[model samples]
Target: MARLRTLFTALTLSSLTHAYIAPISTPSTHIANNDDDDNSDTPLPLIIWHGLGDNYAADGLASVASLAETVNPGTLTYIIRLDDTASGDRSATFFGNITLQIEQVCEELAAHPILSTAPAVDALGFSQGGQLLRGYIERCNFPPVRSLVTFGSQHNGISEFQSCSATDWLCKGAQGILRSNTWSSFVQSRLVPAQYFRDPTQMEAYLEHSNFLADINNERVLKNQTYKKNLEKLERFVMYTFEDDTTVIPKETGWFSEVNGTEVTLLRDRAIYKEDWLGLRTLDEKGALKFEVTGGGHMTLDGELLAKVFSENYGVYGRPFDGQKETDYPREKEL
Candidate 1:
């Protein structure tokens, strides 16, 4: 029985790393705002990070960029990509060191011509990308985030891996690498998902061996207070969980952790929130931490939901993407 469970875990994690690879066109071109969009088009720019198996060039992402412009008219949109090419970026989702990738992201954002000087930017993250952006915020938020919205992200971490075929070579390879020791330095440094693979069942192992989630989630004994400080500055941190999500085991990882080991512990009741780890408690206190729910499986967002999500979260002065000026936006809307 134990062996069967291990095999299942290995295949699931393997496929999850490779799922979501979308079709792409031109992934690198930055969509300009509407012709009339200029410096005064928006008070804040927007940044996005896609989940694993996805490339910046995906048609869906480009449409998202175009949609941002239509919704906000002149909003600037930049989707963070780890690699220069679509294939490379997709490959990055499975390989490469997550810490290095995030550090590289920090440097890239700091070097951005406009982003470096912007007062703040609104951010949107998808799946694993959501946690990565949270890492960015904790590690180095040079251009701090005013608002952050994430969809179907494993924010807390995953114990049960996603589904993959038992016969897949790739899945078999992942089992070979992870089954013996997911805690080994090689696996932690190499496998992207392994970095955040927090098995609540093995609490000590997760805390001691987890390379990414532990640090970013501030679950380690030695905490980085800056992570808390930086995150607290956000005007709002919105999280959306897909109710029928099968891609992320125990899907509640999106709203933090759905369970601790085999026990279900709500976020508000967890120490991570009660103690203000990563400033989640602070954000919640100020009504900045929002827990929202949606229908469908992971990454199954429809047009109306996308429009509502974007329009409500990605605009200047914490306003929706509607054509209203910052001052003209209603104060009650922030709630």
Candidate 2:
């Protein structure tokens, strides 16, 4: 009986050892390979600029980064955080000078090691961030950007409030406040005023001073070839907006509209046919400019939609664990 008990004890110990060793070996192999792969594979880097009054660590920015990662596991997203204090005591970021913001972006790109490499990096900008990026690319010209994707951006300045309804009391009140000569003059006095909401007629005077949209659009400095060349370098210039985007009214501004007419659903009608003031028509002619109109509202985008856009325009695709060749994901019609 003692001999039998000893044999059973030895078998129990052997079983325990095997169980422990088996699990350990699998994880160890996986960890080593994962570490090696992470070190060897350089991820495709992308810079993200958040909307007004948002920070680099904002939840929306995180969601965008996660969505990008889902589509391409190799994406490395960097969010550019601006100085929130620049707007004075109000701490309003939109009120902050866009030229200074562009400078910050340039500084960040110039400093990043991976972003400074040969193949140009991509960028995703939202709202005011989008306009800021446009300004940056047109002016800075260093640190090449391969593609730019903007959401609800006011590229040509938002003029929706200019046409406020006479019947709608709320709209009238808001427009009255913004259009007041005193208020407009006060905004003009500010370091970097919100150019989008400014009246087109008064834009010339603001442009002469410190208006960001005016300077970047080359409204006064049209003779600068470098600005045009810099804009032409972008491989893809994609803009997104919805039919009911009230914030960026006259949504054509998002695509750099040459003429302001009735709203159109199709991309062809919305696009600028002639070489307008913004020079984006050249990009359109090269097939680099793309406009995506969705049924959703402002700042609305999901992983599926983002994946489709990236795959169609940027050649980004999914990578399955089975080690198969990555293919372009089919575009969804519902977006």
Candidate 3:
């Protein structure tokens, strides 16, 4: 029985990886489960962006994409990698190339005859991918994003890896690469507020300024501009976060809360796991529509569990894809 269990574990992980390794192609026409609802346009393809620790080959994007395909067949999905996955060499032009990639994705979708409709192409970015998307939305002025979802992503900035305590739930599992102070420094440097917005006053506006170091509430920038317009009107925004996520813990993670005895009208927005942010309202784009799932590790998102979610919430056909049963995806049966 022990041997059998070991074999199952190995097979399950292998299958999960294989599902994520499949190649990406152009957007395809897919009918929503609610066929009677409205078929005016093809369902917008779902794009899955990989996180920092893992690449397209072995990451959460592939795992989620596998689940999505099973629940909704023919759903279009793509993996956008700013850095090379296998080779750790930094791309000299990672940021610029990423901007180009965003344009290319939109262009590809618009040019596709089957997918060139109002159906909003949604994006789900994991970890740094989420932050990168935020940078794009705030700075590059890419076309309007219909909907956005992020999983275990550090929307603000991540600094908790450097402070991992032995008591923390992630201590044991996050022993190697994640515990590295160097990795933390690398992510921290990338998340400097100036990278996205420049205006010290407008947190979103600061996205324009490339290399300025100023407070979030810069007096000069605030007086300089008022009522800043959103780059792209976001229709739906979802934050799906993992509890006990080691990569970006709550306190040191750069998420801000309201300051006492301060006249600042804009609430000090502190970042939380995507779920807590989503649970606030029926759904608002300011980190709204938060959904929470406890105990799923940073790398593996159980397909069976997400399938259940899709079935219950979205009323979509939630099932296993790629011949791997949903039961096989969960590291723990109860989770």
Candidate 4:
């Protein structure tokens, strides 16, 4: 019995470290739109961002559009495209495009002569979209935004690629890209950490480009300074954690370092397990987590919550959050 218990403990810890698991999802071709062309006075645009290995046209846009209609009738839903559908694998190239999209949207809000001036927007991003937006906001001067919400974002950086065995294709591809000086440098500049380099020469080669990355792109986001700055300017902020979200490590202990060079916030184990939500992290000064919920782990949400958020019915859906207690996350304080 003692030996059996010991084996179980060992296995549990092993699995715990490897807990960040991504879900297999069905690719969606749905686009979100309003029936009428007339714009509303309040342009509460809801933008959706998908995760890594995810294409934007997925169910995310539909989900957010549904939510927007529920909360604010006739709200405009915009699909933030990562790349041109007619193009090739443009993962790295899409960074610049993503930045342009933000700027364009902000400009539209500013220049639209007829629309009544309103709040910036309610942006919802999942996985890589969230992390990418973090980089975008950190690099660009803060923009006007009402609410920023992220689901299963790996704010601290993902470690799963490091542990994958040599035989795994995912591990090989990620490793190959990180090992390449050109590729690794661009990735690191965005405050993204590369994991598992068994070869010293290869690691050194990548580090050679680190200086430029740190000076150029990383200087602003090191401690999440930019993120902190924007947090103060924004109206509301929300982060949703999918408890069993494989993309995010749902740990109960340990403190990971912040993005090197920038005070980008570090990830602590307690912050993960004790968090109101499974994967939500602490915000910079002036920023608050607001609320966190566990349960329907990973990308699944209840139909009712979806209807409540999007303001439309999707039949009887799975509960969006687990059985955790709810907390208010309103940005405005009553006078």
The candidate that achieves the highest lDDT relative to the unseen native structure = 1
lDDT of 2 at 126: 74
- Alpha carbon lDDT of each predicted model: 0.75, 0.55, 0.39, 0.40
Question: Which regions of candidate 3 are displaced past 4 Å?
Answer: 1-36, 39-41, 83-119, 140-143, 160-232, 251-293, 297-300, 308-335
Task: Write the residue-wise lDDT of candidate 4 on 1-335 in tens digits.
Answer: 34422332332223222222233222243223232244343446565555544454444446555555544565666545545561221232223333444455445434654322434545666654665554444455223445566666554444333334556554444444444533343343432223211122333443344422222222222343454455455434455555454434421001222333322333332333234121234342233333444454555555444444332211111212222322432221110
Q: Model 2: per-residue lDDT, tens digit, 27-56?
A: 111111122234345445777776644556
Better of 1 and 2 by TM-score: 1
Count steric clashes of candidate 2: 1
Q: Write the per-residue lDDT of candidate 3 for residues 1-335, one digit (tens) a residue.
A: 34422332332222233123223322344232443244233345665565533456554456567666655555566555444544331221122233444455556545656435434455666654665554444433233445566655554443233333556433333333322321232322332211322212343433333332222122233321110122224544445545455444431121221222222111223232222222222233343333344564443455554564333233212211122111211121222
Off by over 4 Å in 1: 1-43, 166-173, 318-335
lDDT of 4 at 236: 42
Clashes of each: 2, 1, 12, 21
Indicate the residue-level lDDT of 144 in model 1.
90
Q: TM-score of each candidate?
A: 0.83, 0.68, 0.51, 0.53
Which residue pairs show backbone clashes in model 1? 12-162, 27-57
Can you rank all candidates by lDDT, best first? 1, 2, 4, 3
Q: How do the residues 1-335 of candidate 1 rate in per-residue lDDT, one tens digit apiece?
A: 34534453455445543346333322243343332334354747889898877888888788777666765666788989998999888778877789999999999999999998888888989889999999999899978988889988889887755544756766665466565678878778877777888777788988988889999999988889999999999887889887777777667788785476557676877899889888887877666777777777787765556666656666655443332222211121121
Error of 2 at 263 (Å): 8.7
CA deviation > 4 Å runs, candidate 4? 1-43, 86-118, 139-143, 162-227, 250-288, 307-335
Q: What RMSD does model 3 have?
A: 12.9
